[model samples]
Target: MKPAAHVRKTALPGVGTRYDLNTEAGAHLSVVVHQDGRRIISFHDPEDDDACKDAAALAPAEATALSALLTPDPVAHLHQHLEIDLVTEHIPIGRRSPYAGRTLGATQARTRTGASIVAVLRRTDAFPSPTPDFRLALGDTLVVVGTREGADAVAELINGG
Candidate 1:
């Protein structure tokens, strides 16, 4: 029988698992998955086929960020979305806005907007993780996080719409 034409999988004690495969061009590639949701990808040093030189190691979040690169070129898809966009936006408060003179609690931002106000930026001051009791001001800019639709809801809630 010819050499097994499949990637080899090995268990890494106290760590996680490892998978290795040789490309048709004879280059060896390996990926190690750690129990902590981290991954290390490597390529064998061509000069020494017996040894692998780590190419990159990524934490779970970093890997997810890297996966975003796999999507189609963004500039080409500008009018069209390549993926669901979860974004952070800074929304300013106006004097007549409901959030202007009230505490965050009274607004029930999360309950009404389905978005999170993570922080607020006032003139020369920034409040992170502002509590529900924190009072809002006319010039305070809320740093919100959520999908576009959710953010729209938050804008409407702030403006009493």
Candidate 2:
């Protein structure tokens, strides 16, 4: 049988219910369901319990969309609960994108922006764990993960900064 996860439930008077989960990897995550249908998700710093490394306040629809992304793939769900304060974003390669016809390695996105391109979505096809040699094309959407700032920097770099 699979091991059970450690979680704590807290009630905030007039605010909402908060669920704190401690992952097996030693990462901390918190989800607050507000009284007004908003959801706040946050990742805490492992070294400092009082510090929040990353957080996002999501509307009901946005929460649903996030749920959809995490539901089908167990790996994706697991990564979401990991200790890293990283976020996943889909960044599109536009017509003016400098890296459209270049190899992924040529962009050096990870080295330059600290974000890693995990996959690519081109038309109806999905390429998971794309190699550095992968050739990018216009309209292709890059699936990247890192700090929010890192992801944004990647988008900026891909668009010629």
Candidate 3:
């Protein structure tokens, strides 16, 4: 059985840091930060409670102070919730990409998207369980198991969008 895909942690200078995040609902997050001492934190909903609370708990003075310390840019949080639906939404991708090249690992992929690729499709053929080495080619469709937006992103990547 293949593992899952998720966001891994990476280091960034000037900006706080970068991390590959996977939402519990299944989605991919590619985060970046600016050199203005600003930090971009992206993660799953369940994992972001503390940060949310911290932000919510900030008083006017505290907010101003924190804003002064950090960049003035608005914090971007991507998630599928009833209140704030920034992105398209979660779309399930049936399985992993059959043709693979520099594709994310199973564990990493799952961590980010919450869906597993149970099968792979190559041309008119289908692979029930694809190995890690499977190289993805252009025009090769991937049946990912994620949210609608996640599926769209995968499709875009495959279609060179």
Candidate 4:
């Protein structure tokens, strides 16, 4: 899982300081701050993304300003008006099935709390976008997506508790 993007620090006129970050898509970022508060952030990707450019263009003042904008409070406000869809579904597991003995199936089933199960997991493998007839086995895991509550319910059902 990728760490959420955040502002780390604002150093005073410093000796060279650097911070390393990993992006969501598995990329590395190296940022160096100079004594004068100038920053040089480099991205490891061969093809530059807009984030890299934006980071590079950020001066200390701009970085601080951007940091404020990215803060949790302000970001939360921005999302206050956005609507998120909530969906839920139950997947049946067969008795004496391959997935019946394992928690993998239960854990996967929990993921359906507020979402739809678009597939299944069977013995260390995933059935991406499984067909409706994909019979769930004792060890088979359910692939679910929905709101948090729906996912939790599915998980509980799968656990048989």
Among all candidates shown, the one with the greatest TM-score = 2
Cα TM-score per model: 0.48, 0.50, 0.30, 0.32
Question: After TM-score superposition, what is the CA distance of residue 119 in candidate 3 from its true location, in Å?
Answer: 2.2
- CA shift of 73, model 1, Å: 16
lDDT of 3 at 30: 43
Q: Give the per-residue Cα lDDT of candidate 2 at 158.
A: 90
User: Which parts of model 4 have CA positions greater than 4 angstroms off?
Assistant: 1-114
Arrange candidates by TM-score, highest first: which order? 2, 1, 4, 3
What is the C-alpha local distance difference test score of each model?
A: 0.82, 0.89, 0.47, 0.59
Candidate 1 lDDT, tens digit per residue, 1-161? Answer: 34655889999999999988787897888878999888988899766856877679987645655665655554665646557577677777877697788898988888877899999988668999999999999978888999898888888888778
Q: What TM-score does candidate 4 reach?
A: 0.32
Give the per-residue lDDT of model 4 (tens digit) for 27-128.
767677887678777775536533453347467645655575656663556566768755433344556344554434334543444455677755447788
What TM-score does candidate 2 reach?
A: 0.50
- Tens digits of per-residue lDDT, candidate 3, 1-161, equal 34565657667765645656565665545444445434444433454533422212333333334555655334444232356423322222323533245453532444545545555655456666556666544434345665666655555544434
Q: In every candidate, how many clashes are there?
A: 0, 0, 33, 20
lDDT of 4: 0.59
Q: Ten consecutive residues with minimal summed lDDT in candidate 2?
A: 68-77
By TM-score, the better pick of 1 and 2 is 2
